[model samples]
Target: MTKNDEKYLIEYINLKRHEYLNDLQVLLGYAQLGKMDKIFEYIQKVIDKCNDERTVFNSDMDSIMKYIKNKIEDK
Candidate 1:
């Protein structure tokens, strides 16, 4: 891939990773509030959300890398 394409991909990945971390922090805040049942419920939701996000990010990054590989091959 070209230098610009590589740079853009890195930036996008970093941005998404930052957002995911922020989401986890919010969920952790909910867990720390001393409600047993509610904390478990929130933790479960966080687990599900993290799983979904992982799948999506993996798919997206896979696609981006494939596209870059194709571009490099074409040149």
Candidate 2:
């Protein structure tokens, strides 16, 4: 892969990781507050969104990554 491709890939991964980290922070706050019901609902929402992503994208790792690369390059 080219240097730019690698850079874009890293950026994409970092963005996704940042989203997950935010989710974790929220979950942590819920845990600290002993809000089990909120935690459960939050987790369910995350799962549903993940499922929707899979259905909408319909991509494996390689193709999804190519799509991401194209998008990053387009911007």
The candidate that wins on TM-score is 2
Worst 10 residues of 1 by lDDT: 66-75
Q: Report the CA-based lDDT of candidate 1 relative to the real structure.
A: 0.67
Regions more than 4 Å wrong, model 1: 34-75
Query: Model-by-model lDDT, in order?
Result: 0.67, 0.81
lDDT of 2 by residue, 1-75 (tens): 777768878887776687789999999999999999999999999899778667646967667667667656665
Per-residue lDDT tens digits for candidate 1, residues 1-75, read 678778766766666577678877776776787566876786788689768656655777667666545534553
Clashing residue pairs in candidate 1 (N, C-alpha, C atoms within 3 angstroms): none
Among all windows of 10 consecutive residues in model 2, the one with the lowest summed lDDT is 66-75
Per-residue error at 65 for model 2, in Å?
6.8
Error of 2 at 41 (Å): 0.7
Best candidate per lDDT, number?
2
Q: Candidate 2: where is the Cα deviation over 4 Å? A: 1-8, 60-75
Task: List, in order, the clash count of every candidate structure.
Answer: 0, 0
Instruction: Give the lDDT of residue 24 in candidate 2.
Output: 96
